[model samples]
Target: MSEITPDLVRHLGVLARIQLSDEEVQSLTGQLDAIVDNIAKVSEVATPEVVATSHPIPLENVFRPDVVQQQLTREQVLRNAPDQADGRFRVTAILGEEQ
Candidate 1:
């Protein structure tokens, strides 16, 4: 088991340019050691055949049938636009070009 020492934590703090008090160093030493131990346990149980994944359950693509139905008319959609051209919504040209 890897043990974290106060000296190591203090060195890390210096390297990170963080200021830590004696009490904070003592607290972090134990917390870091616990985290390392838990990671070690997980590594032990992991195997070559077991693929590493971020989620516990298998993920699948969920899709719905693609069907077309009656949608809003051109006039109905143009009503919400701040500016409208002959039959389409009008907006300022983005690429420094005139339509």
Candidate 2:
């Protein structure tokens, strides 16, 4: 088992700039010790022969072939615009009077 002492918890609290009370340090020491022990158990089973995987089941990517299709004309697109100028949509200048 990992030795997560109260002193270690106090040192970590100091490093993080947090003022941990005596009660909090006692509580965290037990919690951190349990977490470290569990991690050690997992490490034991993780060997060179065992491959690390994010998921239990295998997954594959499904892709579709890209195909070109008919598109709308410039006039058809500009017809839905709120304002148009020189065959394109026009909006008020944001930064200055220059367009």
Candidate 3:
């Protein structure tokens, strides 16, 4: 188990260029100690035989097979366009840029 001390917290604060008060130093020492202890507990349970996983439950992709089929033609698609030019849909120029 790793033990976090007020002196270590103060040193970290100095390295980080942070000005910590005595109260902050004491509080961070306890907080950091708890974090380290919890991490150690987790490490103890994580053995080499145990597989690491991002999720508790198994995950799989539910994908449909890719199949090609007949689709609409360009003229059929352009029939509903409010405005089109040069065999394609056209819109007003934006941001003062020209085509």
Output the number of the lDDT-best candidate.
Answer: 2
Give me the overall lDDT of model 2.
0.94
Q: Write the per-residue lDDT of candidate 3 for residues 1-99, one digit (tens) a residue.
A: 577899999999998889999999999999999999999999999999999999999999899999999999999999999999998999987887542
- Candidate 2 similarity to native, TM-score: 0.55
Clashes per model (N, Cα, C within 3 A): 0, 0, 0
- Model 1: weakest 10-residue lDDT segment is 90-99
TM-scores of the candidates in the order shown: 0.56, 0.55, 0.54
User: Tens digits of per-residue lDDT for model 2 on 5-46?
Assistant: 999999999888899999999999999999999999999999
Q: After superposition, how far is residue 48 of candidate 1 from its true place, in Å?
A: 0.2
Which RMSD does model 2 reach against the true structure? 11.3
- Pick the TM-score winner: 1
lDDT of each: 0.92, 0.94, 0.92
Q: What is the C-alpha RMSD of each candidate to the true structure, in Å?
A: 10.4, 11.3, 11.5
lDDT of 1 by residue, 1-99 (tens): 686999999999998889999999999999999999999999998999888899899899999999999999999999889999899888887895443
